[model samples]
Target: MKRLFILIAVGLMSTAAFSQTKTDGVHIYNPEANAMADLKAATEKAAKANKHVLVQVGGNWCTWCIAFHQLVDTTVVLKQAINENYEYVLVNWDKDHHNDEAMKYLGFPNRFGYPVFVVLDGKGKVLHIENSSYLETDEPGANGKKKVGHDVKKISSFLKGWTVAAVNPETYKSK
Candidate 1:
């Protein structure tokens, strides 16, 4: 019984550490960071990867924002798609409106609500402004409870739709 208790305690501690390990600014959603700087950095990275920049605008205060983050972090296919095709940037929309200036440049995505998204091409041009609500599903949970989170298939499709595939000039032969 004592050994079992020790094992359980170790498991809990490891799980706690795993979750909190991503609390750094780059991983956790920070409201105080310069959103424009982050956008610029993401744009550069996306350009190098030939991927789009996915800017998620939201605050840590919002439950749905947290839920969306968790969904993307844990879902393997969704996470893989995001990793392979986008540079993810989390822009905060706190009550103090820390990054309002950047939002102005981004066309005020906060108007949609927390956890809205902006997609930018490799060159940093605005491709789309996503209202996250449309990406979610209103289905019953296993316990017959209604839970709000992103639908993996929808997210995968959305990512694929926005992803810019590389072009091989060699393939364009003269007719």
Candidate 2:
């Protein structure tokens, strides 16, 4: 029940939330081209479309990446919003296979942990970089990841805010 709010992948259902097609889950493109070339192309595409590109930096091994994927899968409103305004790309942070220099080129001169989210625009310029810890609080060490607690709501709101007809939170009362 509580877990449903974190959905990061959902189909493009009607506004009524009834039925959606199979392609709702993010296409999650692979080496669409050489990393830099792909990044450049994605940026060009985003810019031409006048929308933002969401680049998720993590591979199959990262736990938070898995969690993020699950959340996106279930986050209906966010999915809809993303489907509307943003083009998403995932930069694989492969450890053993090794893409270190590329990741550094992408963002981290030093390095960034898993689940690093770098948002870019059509021109390939960055819009936002959300790489904080999940807690967003000061802990012992570990750099205290930013809290993902209310972010589900925030992500949903951000998506809707970028759209034309925002989803009024109360209109789902029928549920």
Candidate 3:
């Protein structure tokens, strides 16, 4: 009787663990979310705030996508730059849900690869398509091997370059 109870308890614990989903910091993308609606809403908010829309195109399953998000979240400069200039949105694209309408609206930014970035004006016009690979840095890991991740300075520069003020005709006028 004791053995049977122990086995049942272990089995239940295993089942519970197996049924759990990945809910870490990396799981930023929701497969069920409406990408088009999210983009529209971000654009609307950006229009009102006089900012641009920064759309991150990737799935929750993508490690680089999560890493980039984590880096931006943890880094003060990057977070401030994004907050000051853009309304950020993550549009999930996975095998089960392609988010076709959103992809089309973004000019097929995913053609570059997963974790692509589409910078849009307040009016939803595509200003730039950034392949995330370009923002990555190859640094020596603890194992003495090259490990790649997004570079903070590069990302900050990118964000600054696309800001509304950066693109304004008046900003470029001779003082």
Candidate 4:
């Protein structure tokens, strides 16, 4: 009985570590109205804000995608970086199939491999595109320290570089 209780306690504790943090500034929606006007309205808003539209393209059934989703949900740094720079849009391949522009921009998933991730500029232009590169599977007991996908430090570093006043690689080029 003691062993079972301990196991349950550990399981609950483990779950606590991988849950979504409170999102205060994240715009967690896309404008898909099955019509032109609503889509244009959303697009205009994106343009006005100069926000990067991060389209996470995957089927609703993908566990890897779900893990990434959970990681984004749970990691505070990930949320911070994302909330500051981008408007997140979950482009469902199975149900929604709404990322036609992003798919065309990426051409094909070559770098990170499938599960395409697209970053679009304020004008609805493609800035960068990426793919899934899971360091370790999301299975329980998977090494947390070695998990590269949601490493807060690396992600923060990238955000810092991408958003600095004069050295932002996301916008300007040194010539």
Candidate 5:
């Protein structure tokens, strides 16, 4: 009986591990991508739009990264803000650690955590390395325990703060 129980536990653990590697559902992380070219394309798009490039670094294996992508997809205002101010790109950081050159160029921002953000100007200059954890809020749950999740308002503010319009010379000139 003990052996059977151990087998069952091992099977469950394996299932969980296998699930983590699967990208059958909605996932933004693509570990096999050529991130440098993607970033260049996004920068070009940003230049055309007169916006900045927001690079999201993480792998599909990260639950928080998935959650962040889902939040952006579902939240109307947040999506609009991103659409207006930035050309978004998702760069994969998997077990193989692909895109090392791109990550190195961006100063290795994955040191913060999964789902870290880096904003680049249209000219491809790094402007900010945003830690997504700072955009999350800890609220009390129904069970009276703290639960951390994305705060839409905080993310919107972050987007707005890093936008081209926000950094324009005219805005600074008045001050």
Candidate 6:
């Protein structure tokens, strides 16, 4: 009887442990994902599509990261901008998996903070490291009580600025 009880307790504990890893439908970062592999795949896809790679580096544990992702996911303009200009991926960074190799390749974007944006060219070369704070709005959010969301315009502009055509020298040639 004692052994059965112990087994049940252990099962319950394991379930709880696993449940803590997920947020309430806002899990943008996958701790178990191979970020390096994902980034390589994104770069390849971007190259073929003539687009850039937009990597959002943060863990599901970060509230702001979740908020930013929620905004981008629900906003039509933001989604359009991303789809038109870049291949998007979320790289997890947290206590359990810091993704050290990915971080080094991305030029240590975490130095800025959680939810930092790293723009990479088709060849996997780092082009820009954007601190997410710059994309946030000074005014309060929809509830008009909390200043915890990103500005759609700012994010759209950022995405547009890093597109392949925007960076190509020939794009500016007088025709």
TM-score of each: 0.75, 0.58, 0.83, 0.55, 0.84, 0.82
What's the TM for model 2?
0.58
Instruction: Give each model's whole-structure lDDT.
Output: 0.82, 0.58, 0.92, 0.55, 0.89, 0.93
Best TM-score goes to which candidate?
5
Name the TM-score of candidate 3. 0.83
lDDT of candidate 2 over 31-148, digit per residue (tens): 3335666677777877777677767777665556666666777878767767667777777655454456556666662155776766665666555566535323333345566443
How do the residues 1-175 of candidate 3 rate in per-residue lDDT, one tens digit apiece? 9999999999999999999655355668989998889999999999999999999999888878888998999999999999989999999999999999999999999999989999999999999999999898777889998777988888988999999999999998998
lDDT of 3 at 119: 97
Native-structure RMSD, model 5 = 3.6
Candidate 6 residue-wise lDDT, 4-69, digit = tens? 999999999999998864566666688999999999999999999999999999998898898888
Deviation from native of the Cα of residue 86 in model 3, angstroms: 0.6
> Taking the tens digit of each residue's C-alpha lDDT, what string does model 1 give over 21-75?
3433433576668889999999999999888998998887777787788889999
Two-way lDDT contest, 2 vs 5, winner:
5
Taking the candidates one at a time, how many backbone clashes does each contain? 0, 26, 0, 1, 0, 0
Native-to-model Cα distance after best TM-score fit, residue 54 in candidate 6, in Å: 0.2
Model 2 residue 159 distance off true place after TM-score fit, in angstroms? 5.3
Error of 4 at 83 (Å): 1.2
Order the candidates by lDDT, highest first — what do you get?
Answer: 6, 3, 5, 1, 2, 4
State the lDDT of candidate 4 residue by residue for 36-129, as single tens digits. Answer: 2433444566667755555666654555666577777898888877777767666544445545644455454333543556665666566666
Cα error, residue 14 of model 2, in Å, equals 46
- Runs in model 2 lying further than 4 Å from the true structure: 1-33, 132-150, 157-175
Provide the lDDT at 13 for model 4: 90
